[model samples]
Target: MIRQLPLVAFCMMAACAVPDYRPVRAPIPAPQPEPAPQVNPQSAKERFLRAVEANGCEVNASNSAVILAGATLSQQDLARILQELKDEGRGSVAPDGTGFRVNTGACA
Candidate 1:
């Protein structure tokens, strides 16, 4: 019983004496992002239309021709979309009408 008590006391002391080994953190990185380009929505839309036409008129190819399908954007629809995009404040319009690039600089 006396030997058992000494062993138990040594076990308890060993457990409470453990060393902490926390790792050091690396330095914070600087924001290296470039400022986004700004654009006017109206001008952008016009440019997009031009880009659409510039595709050798291919914007009206089998695929897109189907989407436009004998429909023309009315004055009200155009205004609504413009306002909505303005309220939402950001989106991408393909200048070349092939791919889109979004800019959060708030439609110029």
Candidate 2:
């Protein structure tokens, strides 16, 4: 009986033993870098008109030329402006005997 009690006690102790458990977690993904800002490409005419407007000149476009009103620019300044417009493929600039004009739709 004494041997049986020891064995029974040992069996009870063994039955009471619990296995340790831990929850497994998934690995976190690395953060991705932000994309660069997209820049809109402007046409040559658009750039030219922007410059004209910046110089405080009002521009109007016709089928053959661009008319400038309220502009007090010198002939040399007009020539330089025309050259820049021409270099950008915006077309030639000529004096309309009144105001500056560009053959392209740069003013539009």
Candidate 3:
């Protein structure tokens, strides 16, 4: 029993005096938000119509055509709008002095 006593004491002392040697860990990062989706711009024809409406001009639509008056538009913008209307087969555009007209053609 006396021989076992020293061994038991040594074990108890060793267990109580042990030191940890592992590296410390960093904290977890917070979650981040996703970016918003990209949106496509409107076509030239649609843009032109919107511009006309924004200028307080009247937009008259019938079964065969759309007519507007008193809306100022640039020549380049007008040409693009006309081309867009033609390519889409939606209609054709015509400039009448101070206003513009759109013939819906088969699209009507």
Among all windows of 10 consecutive residues in model 1, the one with the lowest summed lDDT is 99-108
> Which digits, one per residue and each the tens of the lDDT, describe model 3 over residues 6-108?
9999999998898977788988888788878786666656656654455434232331122223224455656666567668765444354333344452223
The true-versus-predicted C-alpha distance at residue 8 of model 2, in Å, is 13
lDDT-based ranking, best first?
Answer: 2, 3, 1
Clashing pairs in 3: none
lDDT of candidate 2 over 1-108, digit per residue (tens): 987999999989997796657676888989999998997766544555655655434333431123223234444655666678668766443455433444444444
TM of each candidate vs. truth: 0.26, 0.32, 0.33
* Residues forming the 10-long window of minimal summed lDDT in candidate 2: 62-71
Q: Candidate 2 — what's its lDDT? A: 0.54
**Per-candidate clash tally:** 1, 0, 0
**Cα distance off (Å), candidate 2, residue 45:** 1.1
lDDT of each: 0.48, 0.54, 0.53
Compared with the true structure, model 2 gives a TM-score of 0.32
What is candidate 1's TM-score against the reference? 0.26
lDDT string, candidate 1, 1-108, tens digits: 997999999999998898867787999999899978885455444543443344332332333443233224444544454455446654444567563332333222
- Candidate closest to the true structure, highest lDDT: 2
Candidate 3, backbone clash total: 0
